[model samples]
Target: MGYLEDQAAVADGLLSLYEATFDPRWLDEIRSLVGEMLTAFWDDGSGAFFDTAKDQEQLVVRPQDVTDNAIPSGTSLAVDVLLRAGMLLGEPSWTERAQRTLERLAPTAAKAPLAFGHLLTALDFHLGPVVELAVIGDPGDSQTDRLLEVVRERFLPNRVLAAGAGPGAIPLLTDRQALGGKATAYLCEHFVCQTPTQDPGELARQLDAFRAKALAS
Candidate 1:
């Protein structure tokens, strides 16, 4: 009944939902579920998640799986979700926990990446070029729609998108505002932002340039 995989799966879904909708409510739910997952499934001594919660009825041995099977292992998926959500939601604590999880499993994953495919995928995201895009304007406006379309269509791996009218609500949009009262897109990496752009074509060029730079590095 207290399965770590089930909880992690739900958390992963919630994370995807948040990305798609940019709804703060989904982020709140993710935070709550992640907190509960840590409290219930985390092994303090090993710093990895157990297959079952501590309070569950004990078998001969509690399983702690790190290898990826047909699907990503629960621990791997949990780490993936945690890292992404942490970055998007500005939760240092969640990111820290995810880092610890990766550190704990790094040795094994390094030696046998094939056995930990999902974990390696997660690690790639951690090490890869991650872009955070913020779009600001009236959500219902045509300009805002065009900007959002450019963002959603672009093929950037390990990307996070946040769109809204103003800055007061979403943390990612804290200081972001429209340029000249027109819908604008801001592309950032490692917390450094580029000049905000209103034209979709300009945004696309900037994104391509950013990816090129990332690849070069």
Candidate 2:
């Protein structure tokens, strides 16, 4: 009730994002898992999602509201997944669910958009384009590690982070590998990709320049 709705909204945003990227595997997993997560805490009569799923074996009374200081709650993460799955998979059912969920959370965002930075970022994504980045390498390697670290510290909510080796790891990066000789970074915006960069400093500079331009627009 309290902030649970806000969390749902942000989650909707992120979900929409993941879907947009065609991560069917991720969607499949979330779709299978979220319902259980919800039932753990949800009170069927409340017409509101809870902070914790109703079925949580760990809690007596699962928290009923969302909470995130600079962002939305874990509830938001769930909602975002729902929203994004609809968009990415081109599923009307998913889209309808996301829209309904967002309608429920709209008032909160309207009343206090700043506090919900994650939700705001999601809203911004729909208005324009989002950039997706895949960083592949030893998550612990120094240079590849530094590159990923720097990217996250920046305000690039439009980007998604994945560390691994797979087809998903390709296309996104200009280079086929990351700095450690196996690591790689792929950047995409508006569904179009730019060459990936292996240089951590260059990636930072590139993102910095892009954000600066985005602000200007």
Candidate 3:
């Protein structure tokens, strides 16, 4: 019985892999998985996702459970990952779907906070300001590592990190240049960027200011 209950969690794992490795392949896989998830579980009329695939054995009632217990609900994980990967990839449709799902669950989540802990966290990412950090540098460069370290050491939750030599195929990395022929960092909020910097200290200051502003809101 190949039930499609954990696809959202699987997509989340791929997102984590992308963050850790900075390999676009993981993101690509996420995109592909998202398509499958939508096709199999998404119900436009209900604005919810079922745990079982559409092609699976028909039951008297399709199971659609969204509760955060020992493991986060598939719906919550789906929304979180969709928001994260969707923003990074510049895909508005994915975020829109995730938002609609949250819209349906908002009142329920409000009344049952303990049961919807993970879903609330996902909502935070949706409602909070998200920082987009694009680090452009050739691989194995110490300058690049330093700039990344400044960002990695922080406990920034609503931030997305994209690192590579150039824009490559990532929309977040596009148009971000390496100033002065050195490793550079571009910090943006909701895709509107700040001045690019090659120094790690300046990057840290920028991230700190951005974090401060995010908190202020």
On TM-score, the leading prediction is 3
**Ranking of candidates on TM-score, top first:** 3, 1, 2
Best-fitting candidate, scored by lDDT:
3
TM-score for candidate 1, residues paired by index: 0.92
lDDT of each: 0.83, 0.55, 0.86
* Tens-place lDDT digits, model 2, residues 1-217: 2234544454454454443343436555555454444454344454445665333354666664443465456555554554444344334554454445456766887888765656555556544445566666655567667767777788765554555444442234333455446666666564455677787777887778778777777
Candidate 2 C-alpha error for residue 93, in Å? 6.7
TM-score of each: 0.92, 0.55, 0.95
Residue pairs in collision within model 3:
none
lDDT pick, better of 1 and 2: 1
lDDT of 1 by residue, 1-217 (tens): 4788899999999977866666668877988898899899987677678889878998999898778989888899888888887888788877777788898889988888889998887887888689888988876789988988887787776787777786644577888888888999999987789989999999988988988887897
Higher-ranked by TM-score: 1 or 3: 3
- Give residue 176's error in model 2 in angstroms: 5.6
Query: How many collisions between residues are there in candidate 2?
Result: 33
The clash count for each model shown is 0, 33, 0
